[model samples]
Target chain A: MFSELNSILNTSPENCPQGEFTLVSDRKADASFLIHHFLSFYLRAGCKVCFLGLVQSFSHYSAVSQRLGVSLTQAREKGQLVFLEGLKGALGVLLEEEPSPGTHMLGFLRSPRSDLRELFEFVRASSTVLLSLGVRVGAVVDFAHYCRAFVCSKLQGNMVMLIRGEDEEEEECDEEGAEWLLRALTHQCSLALRVQGLPTGYCRDIHGQMEVFWRGHGSSVTGPQTQQKLFQYKVHDKGVSFFARGTSSAVL
Target chain B: MLLDIMQTNEVGGLVIIQDTVDCCGRQLLKGFIHCALKRDEVVHVLGFEVCENEFRGGLDSKFTQGLYFHDGYTDPLGWTECPPLTVHHFTPQDINTCLSQSEQLKTVTLVVDSLSWILRHHSPAIVCQRLQELRRGGALRSVLLLLHSDMHQQGIVGSLCHLATAVILVAPGMSGQHTVAKTTRRTKSGRVTREEECFSVSEDLTITIEAQSSCSGKTLPEPEEYEADPAANLTFNLRLSEVEREAKEKLSLPFVFSQEKKSALLHPRPGAGRILYEPDDNDDFDQEDPDDDLDV
Candidate 1:
């Protein structure tokens, strides 16, 4: 699903970039669709996947994964998948109780604190652990409402951050802090993709458009050639597929 | 209108009041508190931007007993000055404790005087996470009144607005005529409706909120005319298109047909001045030519 996106970033499944983060945002796209497609893309390529779901629970993810035929259970048994229920984990930490059974932890699991330093330590440790297991870890964090700073700054694995889109009417809204956050994340991440839902006429399926902004390195070594590509996409019975910008013709 | 909404909204509803730091604008928040207290609801004031004395000074002495102030700035370690009422420091770290405490109250209204204050010490992500947890846990039983000042963390306010069940935006309107408050409510059925009110702030800091009929969708004759020709009515004349605007120089010109100023033109007018034909004074003709020695 994200082959074009990976190719645009000049990254491959076998030789994946480490400690890099990508931000996927939209004002109205279903986050589950975007996140599941992203995870499925990486997992299909034989990469170890760790989904730290802050918005949706494990069961919800399992259902979506099952529908997509991703087989997260079999992958988990083979040590290729780790699903950390971040919402419950965060609630547990807030209540100072141990996360319930079958709960996996990441990013500062030892100390229960919101301090930036402590949070970065968690990212560093988690990535190191996953790397030591002889797998290239790609993590997907469903940042429905909130996410920490280190996830943008310190993670040592390929990261996909999912942020909920705001109302289009509130496009010029007073959330300067959130804008600043998007600005900061945009600068940190190699790719910033915006997925927006487009109204489908007569058809009941969910259709959307994806815009990928790939900024070439500004340094002297690599000549500046920033590229922005737009693709129309749709979520289907199998998974997601991208088509030409204004047409329904799928991009093979 | 806010009071009516407060009465009708469910117990777990979250309402946000976004106001400027101006004194008159801040008084409107007190009006909300007064409304909440009048309903016999226990109100918790999480004062992060303001102090206990600041909020207490505005209200009567009798109503102070029913109000509890969690002075976020004064108390560093979640300690309370008065006994019986436990007030905690409004730190990002202690957000869970605050939410849990509010969960225990059956008919309590939790009000954060200014959420932007927390954003100063912490990132928006952490604040948003805590708020999501608070909303999910149903801790906003009675009401969650989040008052955000436009002083800082302006962007995060959008996310907060997204999470709020109702939003009351207060702004200064038209040279003391009124303070406008636009309240947008998202019903339980997910329908959104917006209502606007024009309120006047009295000398004693009492805010009288009245409906702004002009802002409502129903057409009134005066507003209809105003909308038809806003510039003519002087309703909105701050901006005009280039074609409609009178030339800057033409405004200063009299009827006497003054010459168009050529000095302002970037390109110089050729043949406007005499060309000098002077010889080179530094050239020594006597030294260069031997025949000139006779004349010398």
Candidate 2:
């Protein structure tokens, strides 16, 4: 499903680098395709995947991954995938009585102050997996920081995070926090994939553009030379096609 | 030039290494560490972004004898029980206590791995005040701060820049060969110097600095001499020769009438009026004036 993206990244599913942080972000465009690509990509690599699904429920991802030829239900049955449905968990935390300390994964959401220690502890207990946090980071910027400090530094595992880019209509404070989180993650991540809409407005042939920035320093598994490239992409039912700028079919 | 500034210890007060998302300043931070160690000064690193081993991995071992690492990365909030050095508070007093734990009380170079983390947790005003208080205490020789410029608001970053004695901005160069560092330094005599240079950090933590191509010798490039030419390489001639000019003046176009022809067309002599009439076969000719019967 993501062979072209893999080729552009210069890595295969079998040889995916560990202990690296990959950040996927989008602006004025939907980047959910990238989240699905990484999910199926890592699962095919035979890594234990713990997906912190914050934006959607299990069935939605399951349906999408099934189209991409990866069975999330079977993976769960085999004890290789740990799925945390954030919306359902938050609902449960709201309806249920007060739980014991550090028992629930969404305990931080219940507290008045923003603390993610329990969440980090939960991830630590489920150790040595490719942790994916699919959430809007405007509310929990510190959680991303904690993940960078603990999961990437100590656990020796890879992390893939999805964050929405800034919007002009959003509140000033939330926009600032989201922008800051995006920049901070870009500085820390080994690879940054940014998807943005066409500046000239809506288009028929080309969906959007993506910029891939590979940080050279601190990434030993990848090459030492830094690289930045731009490509135009179109999302399909099962996959996405990435081509160079001005090379879309309509333009030709 | 940056190397010279670092070697001479001309930068004092608070020094900031401002970097963006594309380019990181950790290499420059390590270069500063190398300079401090070469000067035989005690060095203390308060690392919150990266662990101790990862921070000191590429540094030379012999120069690390005077270096001390305080562990703020492992458990900053003290969630775990036995962190070697926990950082539950960010007050200047707490940080001073952490620094005083080292046996050497002499003048030391204090390096904060990043000020962005601290700024995120605390208000910018409180952080700035603490930094000022830390600087005025007289125990530290100088303070080096690493700031992610894009991660903060313009006002916050501006305040930090205004507070610093020098600010070095690291950005990716045209190619990957070297990164660009633009340094803005304020001297003790209230003079300001700004220099931009390209530097590359080697695998062993050594930096090679070179001036940018445009500002290599600190002399502005001379402007090229320009001359105007309307028909530099045209195939057809745009200029007229003297003979062609005279011939053009003598020629009279059909639509342009002479003075005599214009006067003759506008007015005729008194007795020269005549009408040439050829009547058709169906026409009737009468010697009477046409309007005499209707009006006399």
lDDT tens digits by residue: candidate 1, A150-209: 222233346677655444534342333344344434543456677777755323443777
> Tens-digit lDDT track for model 2 on B1-296?
57765776542467899988877788788888987887777778888777777778777788888788888777765677886654446666776776786666555878888888788777899888878888887667789999988777779999988888888898888775688888877767766677788888787767778556454334233355345475798999787999999999998987899997799877877888778989789656566865544545
Index of the highest-lDDT prediction: 2
Regions of candidate 1 where Cα sits further than 4 Å from its true position: A1-12, A45-48, A67-69, A90-119, A128-156, A169-177, A199-206, A217-225, A249-252, B1-296
Which residue pairs does candidate 1 place in steric collision? A108-A122, A175-B155, A176-B154, A176-B155, A177-B155, A177-B156, A178-B155, A178-B156, B11-B141
- Candidate 1's residue-wise lDDT over B148-237, tens digit each? 444444566787788778888876565444667788887777777777877764433345665564555432345555666435667566
What lDDT would each prediction earn against the true structure? 0.55, 0.76
Alpha-carbon RMSD to native, per candidate: 23.8, 9.5
- lDDT for residue B175 in candidate 2, whole number 0-100: 79
Worst 10 residues of 2 chain A by lDDT: A216-225
Task: Estimate, for each residue in A80-105, the C-alpha lDDT of model 2 and write its tens digit.
Answer: 88887776787778778666443497
Query: What is the lDDT, from 0 to 100, of the residue B117 in candidate 1?
Result: 51
Count of backbone clashes for each model? Answer: 9, 0
Once superposed on the true structure, which residue ranges of model 2 sit more than 4 Å away at CA? A94-103, A110-113, A128-139, A168-176, A217-226, A249-252, B10-12, B85-89, B100-107, B213-296
Judge candidate 1 against the unseen true structure and give its global Cα lDDT, from 0 to 1.
0.55
